[model samples]
Target: MIGKLSSKEGVVNVLVSWLPLEDNWYARILDENLTILSLYETGDILLANHIKLENFVIKNILKLSAIYCYCGNSLSTKAYGLAHDQIRKCLFDMNYDKSDIVFNTNSAQLCSECDANFDRVNLPEDFKKNLKKDLKKLKKDFFYRVYDFVQTKPKISIVIATIFALFINILSNYLYEIIMGRANLPIFLVSPFVVIWNYFT
Candidate 1:
């Protein structure tokens, strides 16, 4: 579950949790003083399903009722607090007007104000082309970051295993020499035993 709080001043606080055996659920409420708002939810799927809903809360309080209905069936009451905290943090970090963001269950878009402002920028043809080129470069950079993050775990494991295997081979040969009074064992015989011991140990 994840939770968040947002204030009219644009401050946000976030919290998250995971419980495998629990159902998913969420809720948002105006602060008792009505000076702030909160959104919260619980469930394994809550984060993925309710992210857009959080955006909606930032846009409209009425949308909170709708999101509550959509997520109520899948999450527990405990999840709501976690969801609220996470949403709050996101809102606090955002630099734009909260109302300028709109949520879609299937897709999201900027509010009309943002759309109007964007259109008013009125870039020249060359500037638009340059912007596109920059966006493509940004996408390529993001892709590489994701690729490296995903590849790191497997690569580290492989390197560690190779080094460990080598270490065990050396240790086994030293031990065999000690036991047999310095007679060298065949590489094949020593290597197989080293691999088996490395794995089992």
Candidate 2:
């Protein structure tokens, strides 16, 4: 199982685990001796794995200077499945301990004291509402940061396109001068007409 432990306020120790089961998964959080705890799970542990993979991909994309659409799309699916299986194996090895478990499936809830901590578990409507608010704030913050950066720098795409167009224009002009022997007409005049003719014919 994948586990992380941290201490808060020098008194409360938190352990989080993603545990694999014979046919399912478990996630538990516990204090020392697994006495005070929280657990979550469903028979289908694969859902948690899916979330983990999606989170990873989003983080990866955020770090990239440019996103390759095809590669990102292809890797996302594979990464999700692989993360699920790997987390399952990790949880299995941890023996589903409770004292230090944090994130896990929603199917089962057990504290370190072996008491049912999630017997009254239900989806909190307010949780989603709050989460949406936080997400919107985060999205706004990201866009604002990106806008600030763009304002301070030249756009890479525009710069690249301009250079490309200049190269093509120079090459075509050179070719025309070589073939036509510098006919007294302006290069721009001949170039546009040539482009139009090539497009239609």
Candidate 3:
């Protein structure tokens, strides 16, 4: 499905898709004119077919300024962090600044990079306002779901759980670097949940 937000300069098109076999939800950005701009995809997808990404980005470099990549969630964590980092670095190498890039925890969340500077960007004031409202609702819904799942958990338990999650996140990132042969920040570290869970199981 495609969702769009308009700005005075252009419209930002959010294209969302799901990979049933891999259980990955992917979102990409396109300009107001329906011209493809950002090409952020799942790490697994990029690794499997990087050449296409390379060519597409190269062709649209002029029109592409900012990008938002969705890192995997608890039920599934692949190489999204690694893949996003690589793509951003590649864009940087091609002359895009680090600030031009942004990331979201999942399809439900707004782009942290873009949200922080919403007023400064070309996006319409109404769209930006609505996005902020949507983000709040999404966070609230997510919190309620988590709270229900782990009801009556002690404060200390929450603390310990958080620490353990960080530990595993760091370790998993290290393992991904070693396995993927690229040293970069773990993609999901910025997210609330750090554990990579299995959806197929």
Superposed on all Cα atoms, the candidates' RMSDs to the truth, in angstroms, are 17.1, 19.5, 20.5
Worst-scoring 10-residue span by lDDT in model 3: 68-77
Q: Write the per-residue lDDT of candidate 2 for residues 34-130, one digit (tens) a residue.
A: 2111133531232332333222222222211011111231112222221222223121123334322223221112232211211223323353234
Of candidate 2, the 10-residue stretch with the lowest lDDT total is 62-71
Instruction: Report the C-alpha displacement of residue 42, candidate 1, in angstroms.
Output: 5.4
Tens digits of per-residue lDDT for model 1 on 54-164? Answer: 433333332232122223322223323322212222211131223322222112233443233335544334533342233223112355445545577778767877999
Q: Where does candidate 1 have its weakest 10-residue lDDT segment?
A: 84-93
lDDT of 3 by residue, 79-195 (tens): 122222333222222222222232221112334443454344354337545543443332224554466446756676689789999999989888889679787555765343434
Backbone collision tally, model 2:
19
Runs of candidate 1 with Cα error greater than 4 angstroms are: 1-152, 183-201
What would you estimate as the lDDT of candidate 1?
Answer: 0.37
Candidate 3 regions exceeding 4 Å error are 1-15, 20-25, 30-32, 35-116, 139-201
Residue 86 shift from truth in candidate 1, angstroms: 7.8
lDDT of 1 at 189: 75
